[model samples]
Target chain A: MAKTPLDEIRSSQVWRSIFRHGYPDTERNRTLAALSNIFLHLHPVRVRKSGLGVRYTWCMGGLTFFLFLVETITGILLMFYYRPTGDAAYNDIAALRDHVPLGVMRELHRWGAHAMVVSVWLHMFRVFLTGSYKPPREFNWCVGVILLVLTLLLSFTGYLLPWDQLAIWAITVGSNMARATPFLGHEGPGASALSVHGLPLIHSSDDARFGLLAGPLVGEGALLRFYVLHCILIPFVASILMAVHFWRVRKDGGISGPM
Target chain B: MLSLLLAEGHGGGLIPAPVRSAIDRLCDPQYFLPLFFVAFVAGLVFYRKWTQPKVAGGIALAALAGFGLALTNHNFLEIVERPDNIPIVGMLGLVAFFTWYSLRLAAVNDERIEKGEGPIEKTGSNDRVLVWPDLVFSEFIALILCTVLLVVWAIAVKAPLEDPANPFKTPNPSKAPWYFLGLQEMLVYYDPWLAGVVLPGLIIVGLCAAPYIDFNPKGNGYYTFKERRFAISAFLFGFLNLWVVMVLIGTFLRGPNWNVFGPFEKWDVHKVVVLNNVNLSEGFWIGWLKTGFPAWFGASPANGSLAQAGNVIARELPGLVLVLLYLAVPPPVLASTVMKGFYKRMGFIRFNLLVFLMLSMMCLPIKMILRWTLNLKYLVAMPEWFLNI
Candidate 1:
């Protein structure tokens, strides 16, 4: 029998290699379809019908991850224009906001950061309320928590990048709090205490606050440090933790369902 | 007295407290954590563990606590900046609670069997849908909808930008980002180390360790508030009541000098309250220790020696007892009563760990109350080292 163009392509080696299976008409091929593709493999071959219910899992975690991807793309685009310096930081943002083409990318990134924090929080809330953070899925929950903290850190560090009145003072207020971190801060409790010598182990210059801001205040050094943290360090750590989080979700028997 | 509660900053005089000053009211569970123990006891009686499961009792207790705290002040329903945000925040919280409540009534968990291989072991019928079309299609739609939302939001509200970073000219209020405003609010009530570093660190650590520390195995892979009532309730209290409340207070109530403003009051830059933010040591030394910190312990109590420290301690003995009771008492009580099953389930090691974390978590509310009620800035105030609470 003479095959049509569709059938011909389906039978051809090119299509066979690309798809690695038939049109997924049958159940066997459907499972294979998910198993064979890297992207599809992220999802299980077959998730329970119950697990698919939005009523149960609010789809918050997935939404958060999606927002993260949006942020990554928009943030990268923003990095090209952003100069995270003391003098030019605010000016650069103004330029990006006002003059740059597709300047809405900055807005998207900004809003996305806000949305991501919100979504991540909701995701955690959803998980906790549902008791999805139980045994067999315990460590994954820890990863999720770390991811939450990382998300907040990312938002905070990115906040300073704007270097405007809000950014400058907010970071100052936020970072200044660090100087009073009990054992870690120079001004904190036990920072001055020693068994033998009266010489304090940590002083104003040698505390967590000092390390965070290279000097005593939020100046040039702090701006540069925050930029690097906002751009590079936090995102790097977050992505790694996120990767672990997703992997663990799959490893710990996919998403939870009615037991 | 009314004028003090009505003082410029952080609250509306409309929401009256059952005391002389609203802050001085012996309420606001964030400070008076001992109140939680009362609620827990009442919940235990209300639930009667034999007949009921975990759901209704916890919610009732939550409601009770809410009702109690509302007696102090609830600006949640009050208007602040605009009308939209109030309904949004209100609905957001209400919807989640109702969803859980409705799900309980539905008995959604009972219809299903345990998972083995996949959910619904040996149903024999193929209830599973194909992933490629079914899952991907839904996700794609979600992606589109979310992107539209983000775009619309971006268009509607232009992300705010102010003058360039100026160290010299601090803003009038000099606020942190809206998110950290809660911590900033805490700073008004607590020492910087407690508000800024320790508390934040504790929250993170507690959250991360929650799953591992909790030993219950009933509500795995399912949504049942009944089986895990106490755990879920504690979380709702902390997350919604404490953290969310702090965020709200930080955002709306606080004004210049971090003084609380009434909801109806205009944020006039000139608005000022004559505040006497006296530390405990200063309060103790000047107020109580009329002569000097009993110099018997060491030379010159006022000379910043250990004797001076002892004087501060002796003066603030009531605060010390309250602090001790707030932190030390919850665990043994929980283990004996309401949280007994969990205590036994977790054993000594895990139980104590959870208790430590729980107590620390409880301290946030307790400290907050103390601030409001007594203007008690620190449970353990050490002025020289900048460590309070």
Candidate 2:
């Protein structure tokens, strides 16, 4: 009524159109505020204040999500320079590190990858420690474990992109582990154990690692395949799992508080 | 347009020699970080004792001040020469935050209790804060703080880039990434099939299946280790003793050709420790009978039952018994005694699942100890293709 600055902005046409609600100061507006916003969709209209305790969650889940977002951004920028080829990939990484504008993007992405893994682990640990994964939240916890595995895969695949000695050998060590993966591996259980008329089930030609690398070993083909898995495949799967994870968190009555 | 990446500033400050040297030592990530981590863990125990949050805050502030000062005057170039500095700083920061948070949580609980209330403060949706402004503001604050920290770190320490991909020119200690260092350490005590493949699969499966199997409703939605002693102790043992210990060993103690070098030991390229790995069959024949393989069982000519006899009765007989005893003895013992309550509470299927998980989890440490003391590689190492496990 006095035509104050606060009243002026709230009454403005542009503000009204964009926000749909002014200052979420009332109950109706608070509900509307959560409902109207796109990003806020992840949240319930309210949370138990007990769940808001820093020690309860340790901010691990939030930090993991933040790191993922950082990785997404820095990764997209990296894609602008990276070429998923044996010849060009290593050189591209070197160029990105040395010559590119805001070359620290590479470093950010690298460090972000490491941070995401650690945070995801801690998040799981927090969930377990609190017994938050009990009962109705069991499915969400399983989803979280899947997401954890996906995170590891993402890191493993991304490891080869640098195409350095560290990258190559690490991938070699990691990929070799697949050979002992039960039936899917050439040397794993049930591979040689199951012989239908002297024909082994899984052979060197059709093992999990062979399928992963697209060749006998970690080479150019492996690098290209890993690039696709890292960039396109794993992230997409992780995102879907994460969506369900967050949805379940809300559906299961938000974060676990005092029982 | 090249964004000017600022040259890292790591100048010597106006601090005195002795104090600076002490600060330097206290901040020497290798020593300080581990000690700080242990201190933080101990602090967490005390923190739950309903301490004043202000004390925690004061300590955090002191740590931050000291750490910040160290960062300002510290020789980043020298420290940055090692790739581990990122984790060092990140870990220290997290520990500091954790200490403060733990004490704060204790204080909050104390306050709640003093108000003639329970641990839970449940309010209806009417008392809720708006997700848009209230929640988003805090999240954005966290995100922005993280972004700034990451940016500063990225600018300060350039990501490590080793030589180009060369399969022929392997590193002296061709290490996996830090995350997989635990597995790498396992490779020391186990066959690749076991350590790199089987154990990892089992761990993942066990973790995924944990919540479903675990039906102890005692510690749900609370942080009391007393209520969830088994869960807490098991998790802490696996985490701190197994995973963290292995990773540290892999990262620090493991040197050229994967020898056990001490923290202060220089990694000599030629330092080789000869290890004789014996398969189950070999161990049986050579270890027990003191005879060669083919002649041990008196089966030379190519026959099926003879091979089976050699396998079941000859070589694998004692080993199989030992393995069976190892797996079976623990469950009935646990069921009758210490974990009898868990066995009763978790029911048949879930109880069996839990026991299986626990036994397998116990195997890692048992195997590790055997490796350390007795130089035992695998319990039943056949090395016969898929039957290795």
Candidate 3:
């Protein structure tokens, strides 16, 4: 019988040749070999290398990725029921929690976001403690740091999407807070008559907020902007960076061991 | 406070009525059954890949089946509806049981390994548990404590879901969470752009880049403050100084309308006097320039009736000193000390860089403090010539 593409991909001799390792005799070895395969490349490679245990570092980076995956899955599931319009966004979120078939997705996404921030910080802390950022791994550390910021940005941008009171005010206060950046600050240089070539880009109290929200405070445009950023833009950027982060870890000779 | 507690009791516990309903709804069998089944399946999969794989997997599967049966028979729904505090009690009991079970499991596993009969075969080449026992124990304790505290807090003080957030009725003090108080506090001191965007951006960037910045491998497993004493001290000093300045500004300097606790309510006299007395143009420019002074001289500007002027001087001085120190101190110090002392002291380069980074971090607090001392009204009142970006 002829095989399907997925079946062929799964059972192809070339796939088996490249991926399957060991004698393939023992159950344990077979499991390990399967995990090590290119098809299952998402999992870390098996090695006898050791320094500190999972207890010390708690696999924070991996756990953070796990939480991110959880968020993405749940977030996408949420979009199925959620409407991003001003009139419906808040009500939709409420309905997801109060009326939808699987409302736990919302709570999971919310809690997962908080957990991701924590796990990412701990990951960075663990990396710091292990002195993993030294020499050859310095660039990777920088990339990891940028990933951290993107994670926070993802959370901050997403905070407004639900259109709840907490979401609304938090973003308002957050954006209001953004108005204090030097050039971007509302009271800063470009915010006043003080300008270059007489172009008043940010020349009023509302300018910074206006630019951020794409208008005066959180409105329809702001909702859509935040929705795009949260679901599509930031996550896409984060995933690409995360891929680099993981690949660099391999390039940097795996996780740094204790001195 | 006691009266408030009594009043709250009369109103029906700390948990708001709506939130209680939400909790009740969450505890329903419809919610629990699906969640439990999912967790059971996941746990089974994970267990299957590890020690006693088949047995653990079987038990998890059986548990899931039992739960499903109960759900179908309406038995679980009856248990949920009974409301004899059984759910809470059961959860607590489950937590206690799990704690005991895990400890026993660990002991048994350790005994097995010690007896030369390992609990599970080392299947994968990388399957060796990399986690240190001490770290594991510490984490376990921490997790247990955090869980207990969170559960207790949730039960004790039910957080009232605030009236679904209304945008138009902006609160008098529309602040972020307490963690962000340090930053929000800065809005009182610095330009909103600096407070809101640049400073926070720097801090986040700094935190992210921390592993890269302090790249010495000599201090693994040691606390940062203990191993890299000077660098850590400098960083802490910078963090605390900025935090203090911001908090002070948030607490005292914000206008009367925004004052949450009014200890310095009468101190509006100072604002009135400054508003009435100081020449806006001369003071503003002089103030702006003074921000650059304490860097030249090691001494900070004095505080009191001249606090506004002193603050201006104090804030700018540190920044100026920091810039000069970065440019001048390192190369000269390196040349005189490390270069002269040893031929192969590439380590000194790292040390100097670390010091420079720490010093730069200190500048954040300096900038924050200066901005705080300047107060919001001044920034609002200042003409373009006096304002420095």
- Residue lDDT tens for model 1, B358-389: 88877766665655566655556656656466
Model 2: residues with Cα > 4 Å off, grouped in runs: A1-15, A196-201, B1-81, B88-127, B276-298, B304-313
True contacts kept of each: 0.72, 0.60, 0.28
lDDT of 2 by residue, B7-119 (tens): 24424533445776564445322444356457645754665552465665676678677645544443432332365445634643553354355335445644555585534
lDDT of candidates 1 onward, in order: 0.70, 0.72, 0.53
Error of 1 at B124 (Å): 9.7
| Candidate number with the higher TM-score (1 or 2) | 2
Which one is best on lDDT? 2
Any runs in candidate 3 off by more than 4 Å, and if so which?
Answer: A1-40, A100-102, A184-186, A190-201, A204-209, B1-166, B177-180, B204-217, B220-227, B231-360, B363-389
**Chain B alone, model 2: TM-score?**
0.72
* Residue A8 displacement in candidate 1 (angstroms): 7.0
The candidate, 1 or 2, that scores higher on DockQ is 1
Q: Choose 2 or 3, whichever is better by DockQ.
A: 2
lDDT by residue (A137-244, candidate 3, tens digit) is 778988888898788788888877877665677678777755544566555544544466755556443566677787667778889898989999999999899999
